[model samples]
Target chain A: MRAAVYHGPRDVRVEDVPEPELDGPDDAIVRVTHTAVCGSDLWFYRGESDRDPGSTVGHEPMGIVEAVGEDVRSVAPGDRVFAPFKISCGSCEFCRTGLHTSCVESDGWGGDNGGAQGEKVRCPNADGTLVRVPDRYADDEDALRSLLPLTDVMGTGHHAIVSAGVDAGDTCVVVGDGAVGLCAVLAAHRRGASQIVAVGHHEDRLALAEEFGATDVVAERGEAAIDRVRELTGGGASHVAECVGAASSMEAAVEVCRPGGTVGYVGVPHGLDGGLDLFSFFGDNVTLRGGVAPVRAYAEELMADVLQGTLDPAPVFTKTVDLEHIEDGYRAMDEREAIKVLVEV
Target chain B: MRAAVYHGPRDVRVEDVPEPELDGPDDAIVRVTHTAVCGSDLWFYRGESDRDPGSTVGHEPMGIVEAVGEDVRSVAPGDRVFAPFKISCGSCEFCRTGLHTSCVESDGWGGDNGGAQGEKVRCPNADGTLVRVPDRYADDEDALRSLLPLTDVMGTGHHAIVSAGVDAGDTCVVVGDGAVGLCAVLAAHRRGASQIVAVGHHEDRLALAEEFGATDVVAERGEAAIDRVRELTGGGASHVAECVGAASSMEAAVEVCRPGGTVGYVGVPHGLDGGLDLFSFFGDNVTLRGGVAPVRAYAEELMADVLQGTLDPAPVFTKTVDLEHIEDGYRAMDEREAIKVLVEV
Candidate 1:
């Protein structure tokens, strides 16, 4: 089986790796049908994260179950399913409270079980971690595309907005232009935010944000972007989504939020050596929420919306490549040639 | 009129200050019947805050309105009322949304207006900042003592629990032994916390916490305290009130919160040069809320409980001093001779 393997910084190789097999009684084998390069993956590909050099990559994937161990009850062979980035036992105190992202049994980042960007991958805790899509949409590519993002990106975006307590009539600011940030705009829109401001520097991404229901766009960075959002919203936005994990984006999210507002931060923090200003956030009466997203907790409802044709998050996949060209997908996304790269497995 | 004036660090003098007059259209002159030495007041007495020397310094007060300006409609002269620590215009976006602590027109920390530890105070935004008490309890000292803490300490404590989203069946942790933290235990109890764990070092304060409704008390500090709390709660408390402003206390508050739980922090942060670890908090999926408490927002409800005899928080006042002996109140509180000092103005 061929799998995307990381060799070193800015290096990825599709190598003929040993195929994954059901290793635990609760595990299942998934034949990858679709996967994508995540914005967070850039941290490792760019030699930024402390991720081991030779580790298998990819955390997002949707596929058909090819085999299941004895204890796997919720999913069966040949069932179409979405695998959340984080695996969970579903019965722990954390998972029981819908905090699957912090499930004690699973490795926090999906590395312990198997990588998704492969022909065949092992999924642990299959009954709790995998969401089976309705059979009616199994043959529909567009519907599948819409559901794919729910496995991680769309669900995570929803987490950001929900964590920030975005409600109807709220002015929401999304500070990032990546696929997740764009999805956050859609999430805020779906959540009935009265005004949605997307802050990003890229014209193309900002345009995509507008398409995804952003009522305003701030093309500036740092303080200028916050100023634009404040001006557009008539003050500060009542809710903000910090979709980019960079310190500057976090600052922008806090700056744009109104007093007593919340900043839902979902971006994986990178290079935040200076730490967050507790005094400033305290003074502003801002609440910061959203962490490793409990995607599995939100995936069912979001997928239902996708299946019903009410939500189409496929636009976030600006470009798609064959599984053999997965390396190009990484390059395109890393070099800013694509907003998000979807790999057809 | 005599008022407690800041002479310098470790120095407070009851000097003859000019009598307060109704200066603004919305102002009222309150003849302060009672004031208290707050834990935060010690910050000034110890020269921790940037409070100006010779400035009047107290925030908690309850008294009878002596005079009211023409625009003061909600409160009238001779009415018994409580003045919250922070004055608010009640008309700004922040105040309207119940974030009166962040009111635009009034300095968030009541600096522009005179302090409460005086014979009289010119209360700004009287209609919004003062909550009128029903005349039935005007002559009841116990009721006054119960209501006095609501002006700042109790309300701030309530803010911490409320901000942390403590609800029925929740396990809550209060992370301080100060009057505010003790009140937090009571707040959590009133809010229906099933198990309230008070974390502090002082045996006397912890005993007060038990009286105020702490189901468990962990007298350890730092990591040991966190371990004890985690063990007691079987993992971590669902809600935490960080009433101590030290970095260690804040860290403990976050450490003891369950995944996706909230930590309401009302402590005025000091010596937080390192800031908070965003990465750890993000990974744990914890939410940090609470700023300077919007006492005016919660005072009315809390005071109602006091007036109705549903709550008797006066036990927190271990000692009382007359206005002339106000310096002794400060000394007793500073030396830890008292939990809280009630000042008979």
Candidate 2:
């Protein structure tokens, strides 16, 4: 199998790798047909976060099931399916409560599992981790492309809205204009947010945010951004979705929330140059919520919307690549030249 | 007029002061009959938190309305009433949503309004800030005592539970055994928590926690406490009520929450000798919530429970003092010689 493996900082290679084999009764082999490079992936690529030099990369996977262990039931060979970034046991206490990210028996794609940005990957707890595409749309190319993001960004964006407890009449401030942030704008609109404010520096990304249902945008930085958002919100919005994992981004998210509001964060927290001071939110009675999102929990609902044409997060993939040029996808995203890169495997 | 004035650290004195007059049309002069020295007061008293030497201090005030400004309506001259720590205009956007603490027109007890620990307090936004007691309990000393804590700790404790979203069958871990923590145990039980664990160092307070409806108690510190709590709850609890604001207390509160759980805090954050790191909670998907609780928001409901004999936070006022010995009340609380002190004005 050909896989994208981490070579070192700024070096991702599509090289021949041994095919993954089922290591457990609940495992399944997936022949990935689509995958994407994530903002988080850049962490390791930039050498800012720890990642083994030879480890596999990428988490999102949309593919056809090549084989399934005898214990698997929800999915089987020849089924078109998609897997959430994290593998989970559906019946575990956490999973049963819709906290699949905290499932008692869980494993994440990439690394030992073989990268999703590859020809084949092994999925643990297939019944819990994989969602089969309806046979009717399995051969619908555009629909399949739309469903790809449900495996990660789209679901994570939904998690931000859910964690923030956004309501129909609420004002939501979305920090960052990345794929997840843009999806969050759409999610907030779908959840009936009366006003959605997208704050970021990129004019183009901010424009996409507006197209995705943002009622306002603030292209300022630091205190100026907080001031602009607070001004537009008459103090601050009732809900804030933090989609960037930077200390400054978290600060802006918290500062742009009204008293008794909530800041739902899906960003993988990074760059805590020191510790993040959260005392201001405490005084304002703002709740800090969310984490590594339970993307699996939200995938079904998000996929439903995508299929019904009520949501279209696929637009976030501004660029596309093939297996051999996966390195370009990484470069494009790292340089902010692409919102997200879709690899048509 | 007499009021409690801060002379310096460990020095509180009840001294003659200028009487309060109608400062605004929304004001009322409250003849405080009962007030309690709070745990937070000890912060300023011990010089741990900044306090002006000549500033009047105390937020809790339960009394008979001596006079009301022409515009005051919800409360009147001679009406028996109590005020939440922070005064708010009942009609503000924040107030309409039950976040009175963040009201656009807001003021607090203490300082220029005249300290609640004294003979009288001139309340701004009397209609919004003061809650009138029924005529039946206006002269009923015992019922009034039970309602006093509702002015602060009782409602604050309720805020913790509300913020944590504890529900039937949820296991709640309360970190702190102070009056607010003990009250949180009661609050969690009221909200129908199946199992309540109280964590604290004080044996007497822990015993009180059991009486207040904690199903278990962990009288340990640091790692031992975390380990014991994790073991007892089989990997932490679903809800954590943080009633003590110390960094360690917040850390313990977050550490004991299961993934997807929430930590509701009410302690006046004082000792932030350094920034607090919250990355662990982010990794676990646990939410950190609650803050300067909108005590007024939960006061009426809490008062109803207290008046109905279903909830009684009065026991937390374990000692009694009169105006002349107000300094003793402060000392008792500051020295940890009393859980709290009830001041008979």
Candidate 3:
């Protein structure tokens, strides 16, 4: 198997590596057909976040199941499937309650379990992690492209808006123009939000957000963006999605929400030396919900939508590459040359 | 008319003051019959929260309508009524959405409006803020006693549970033995929480919590309380309410919430000189909701329950004093001699 390995900062190499073997009866092997570099991956790629030199990378995976261990009943060999970024034992209290990210037996898609970016990766807790694609669309390339993001970003965006309690006739403010933020706009639209405001600094991404069903877009930053959002939505929106977890962005997300509103925050919290300034949330009666998304909990609904042709998030992938040139995909994402690079395994 | 006035730390004086007069078209004057000294009052009483010397005191008001402005229609002179601690314009975006605490033209029951502990109070947003008791129960002393706490603590506790999304068969954990916390136990009980755990310090108060439907009580504090609660709930509860707004207590409330759980915090966030640690919340997928309780929004439903004899938070009032002895009431509350003091005006 050839997997992408971190050599150092700005260095991700596709190297021949030993294939992952099942270490537990709940495990399964997935031959990666599609994967992508995530925004979080840029952390280690830029040397901002530390990573072991030879550790495998990537957390999103869509592929065909090559084999399954003894206890894997729901999915078997040759089934077209995909797994969420986080692996979990579905029967745990957390997973049963739809909080798979906090599952007691949870682990990520890297290191010993093998990276989703690899040609062949071992998946623990297969019954609780893998989502079998319907046979009717398993060979459909466009459908696979649309369904790929459901394994992570799409579900994450849905989690953000859903946690914020976005409902029909709601005015939703989505802060960030990243793939996750754009998907949140799409999600708010699907959830019947009457008005969607996408806030970001990138013009191209903002345009994409508009295409994703944003009724309004605020390209400004800080106070100006807050002013425009408030002006557009009367006082402020009741549902705001914080896609960028930086303190300033989260604070702005709170500011743009109406009193008693909720800010669903899915972005990984970083650069917050002293955590968050929660006094503002307390004073304004704002709720802060969401964390690392439990994508496995949301995969079925999103896949159904994709299969029905009512939802397509493939537009988020602006570039595509083969497994042999996975390094170029990382470079493009790190340099902002692509919104997201789809790795064609 | 007489009212409690702040002199200094540990010094509250009852002094004659001019009777309140209608100042706005939406104003109404209420002859206060019942008021209570709140846990928050101790902040100013202890000189921890800044206050103007000689300011009128108290907020919870349940009384008779003595006068009404030309525009005050829903509530008129001679109606038996109660108002929330925070005054609201009822028609603003925030108020119409049931977020009365953030009403644009909002104010409090002190200063020119007269303290709720006074003989009379001038209400600015009478139509929006006042909840009239049915004439059937207006003169029922027992019903009035049960309804009075709805003006503040009871409604606050209800807000905490409601925001935490406590549903039938839920396991709820309530932190704090204050009036609000005790009321929270009652609220969670009413919300159909199957197992309610009350975490507080006072054995007597925890006993009251048991009466209010706390199936379990942890008399411990800090990490011990967290451990005990986690053990009792078999991990942690999905609904935990924070009625005491200290950082340590709120953090404990968060710690006791299971992944994807919500911490409904009605405690006014005070003493947090810096801010809060939100990293724990993000990592565990915990939601932080609720703030200054929008008591007015909860008043009608609670009042209905009280009038029907299904709810009674009256036991929270462990002592009673006439208007002339309000200073003594404050002293007793300050010394922890009373869980709460009911002031009969």
True contacts kept of each: 0.83, 0.80, 0.82
Off by over 4 Å in 3: A7-11, A47-50, A135-139, A323-325, B16-18, B76-78, B134-142
DockQ of model 2, rounded to 2 decimals: 0.68
Clash pairs, candidate 2, are none
Best by lDDT: 3
Per-residue CA lDDT of model 1 for B35-110, tens digit only, reads: 9999988988988877788798898888999999899899888899988888888898888889997888765223
* Order of candidate numbers by DockQ, starting with the best: 1, 2, 3
- TM-score per candidate: 0.94, 0.95, 0.93
Q: Chain A alone, model 2, TM-score?
A: 0.98
Reference contact recovery of candidate 2:
0.80
The candidate that achieves the highest DockQ relative to the unseen native structure: 1
True contacts reproduced, candidate 3: 0.82
Q: By TM-score, highest first, what's the ranking?
A: 2, 1, 3
Q: Which stretches of candidate 2 lie over 4 Å from their true place?
A: none
lDDT of each: 0.86, 0.89, 0.91
Residues A120-192 of candidate 2: C-alpha lDDT, one tens digit per residue: 9999999999999999999898998899988899988888888888989899999989999998999999999
Docking class of 2: medium
Question: What digit string (tens of lDDT, one per residue) describes model 3 on residues A1-345?
Answer: 899999899999999888998898989999999999998899999998899999999999999998889999999888999889999889988899899999999888888888989998899999999999998888999999999999888999999999899999988999999999999999999999999999999999999998989999999988999999999999889899999888899889999998888999999987776667877798779999998899899999988888988888999999999989988999999888898889998
Model 3 CAPRI quality? medium
